[model samples]
Target: MDLALYHPAAGYYTRNRTVIGPRGDYFTSPSATPLFGRLLARQLMDFREEMGYPAGFAVVELGGHRGQLRQDVLLEAPDLAYQVVEVGDPLPAGLVGCFLSNEFWDALPVHRVRVAEGRWQEIYVREEGERFADEMGPLSDPRLEAYLDGLPVAWMEGYETTLNLQAQEWMVQLGQCLERGFVLSIDYGFEREEYFSPHRPKGTLRCYHRHTLHDDYYAHPGEQDLTAHVDFSALIEAGRQAGLEPTLFTDQGRYLVGIGQELFAEIAERTAGQFSRERQAIHQLIHPSLMGSAFKVLIQKKTS
Candidate 1:
C-alpha cells in the first residue's frame, strides 16, 4: 500500500499529474470550489485574531497540493505566514497558528482485516504476473486485533474493514509540532459507532480513477488513488492523549454555512444574471446532497 501511493519514483502522488482537478484521480472539497478556500480563509483569520495576532503566526498546511488552499487563504489574509508542507519536507518549526489539512488521512496506507471463522485475520496483497491478489492469513500484527477492541461485540462477527493507526499517531505528532494553536482537519468519515457498524458490510475503502469511484484497491498499481474513510473517534482520542482539546466537530455543510451565510447571500444578491461559475462551485461545496455532507470539520486546540 505504501509503495503504491508514496514510493519515491512511481507513487501515485509523486507522479507528474499530481492534482485534484479533472485530470487527477479524485476531487477534494477545496478543489471542488474556490469558495471552500475562500470561506475557510475567514475561519483561519479568526484563528489568527483569537491568538491576538502573534508574530510569525504560521498557517501550516499538510498535503498542500500546489498551494491551492494556501493561495486562497493568503489572498485574503496575507499577513499570516503561509507554508504548504509536502511529504519529506521539514515541518514548520514551533508553529503557533492553524495546522490545516483536507482529505489527507484517508490516503495513508492501512491494514485490511476481516473476521474469519470467529477469529480476526489480516488481508495480504501479492503480485502475480503483473496483477495483485489477496492472501488472507493470521493478523499481521498484534495491534491489528487491538484496533477492534473497542468495537461492539456483536458487530465483530463478520465485519471487515481497515485499521489506520497512522492517523492517530499523526495527531500525536502534529500536537507535539504545534507550539500553541488550532488543528483543523477536514475529511469524509464517521464517528466510531457508524464506522464500526454491522450495516456497512463493505467497510469504507474506495479507489478513484478520473473522477469515477470504485472498489478495486489493488487495481492499476500506482495509477489510481486509494482511500478509506477516516475514523474521527480515534483521532479525537489520540488528540486528547496529546493534550489537544476539541473545539468543534460538525458536518462541512453546517460549518461553512455558519461561517459564510451572509457572504453567500450577498454574492447571490449582487450577481443576478451573471450565471457565475464561482456561485456554482460554492453551491456544490455547501449543498447537503453533495460534497458538503460527505465531508466533516474537526478543530482542536492546544494551549501553553
Candidate 2:
C-alpha cells in the first residue's frame, strides 16, 4: 500500500496532484473552500493566544499537497509562519504551534484483519502472476494483534477490519516534535463505538476511481485511490499515550458552525462572486447529509 501511494516515484500522491477536486477521485474540504482554512486560522490564533502568546509561533500542516491549506491560512494570517509537511520532508523540528491535516490519516496504509473459524487472522496480500490476491493467514504482526486484544469490536465470525499501525507511531513523532501546540486532524470516520459497530461487517476499506467508489483494493493497484475510515477513538488514545491532551472531538459541521454563522456568511460572499457554486460547496461541508456528518475533526493539545 505504501509503495502504491508513496513510492517516491509513480505513486498516487507523488504524481497525481491533479487527481483531486470535482473532476478527480475525491474532493477534500480544503479543495472545496478557503473558508475551511480561514476558520482553522481563527481557531489557531485563539489557541496560540490561549497558550500565552509565545514569541516563536508556527503552524505546520501535514499531507499538504501543493500547499492549498497553507495558501488559504497564510492569506488570512500572513504574518504567522506557515510550513507544509510532505513526504520525505522534515516537519518543523521542535516547532511550537499547530500541526494540522485534512483527510490525511485515512490515506495511510492499514493492515486488514478478520475473524474466521473462531480465530483471529491477518489478510495478507500476495502477487499472483500479474495481479495481487488476498490469502488469509495467522496474524504475523504482533503490534496489530496486540492492538485488538481489548477493542470494542465483538468477536464475531467473518468480521473484517483494518488497523493503521503507522498512525500511532506518527502521533508519537508529532508529540515529540512540538514542545507545546495543537494537533488537528480532519477526516471521515467515527469513534470506536460506531467505527467498530456490527453493521459494517466488511470494514471501511474502499477504493475510488474517476469519482466512483469500489471495494476492491486490488483493482488498478497504483492507478486507483485507496482509503479506510479513521478510528478516531484509537487516535485519541494514542495521543494520550504520547502525553498529549485531548481538547475537542466533533464533526466538521459543528466545527464550522461553532466558529460563528456570521463569519461563514462573510466568507461565502467574499470568496465567491457567483455564490451558487460556493454556496453548494459550503452546504456540502456543513450539511449533515453531505460531507458534514461523514467527516469529523480531532484536536489534541500539548501544554506545560
Whole-model Cα lDDT of every candidate shown, in order: 0.84, 0.85
Could you give candidate 2's per-residue lDDT for residues 8-125 as a string of tens digits? 7778888755778887787788888887888888888888888888989888888998888888887887888888888889866677888999988999999999988877789998
Report per-prediction Cα RMSD to one decimal: 1.6, 2.2
Alpha-carbon runs more than 4 Å astray in model 1: 153-158
Q: TM-score winner among the candidates?
A: 1
lDDT of 1: 0.84
Candidate 1 C-alpha error for residue 160, in Å: 1.2
lDDT per residue (tens digit) for residues 17-135 in model 1 = 76478777677766766677878888988898899988878888988878888887777777768888887888766789988999888888888888777777788988778788888
How far is 267's C-alpha from truth in model 1 (Å)? 0.7
Q: What TM-score does structure 2 among the candidates reach?
A: 0.94
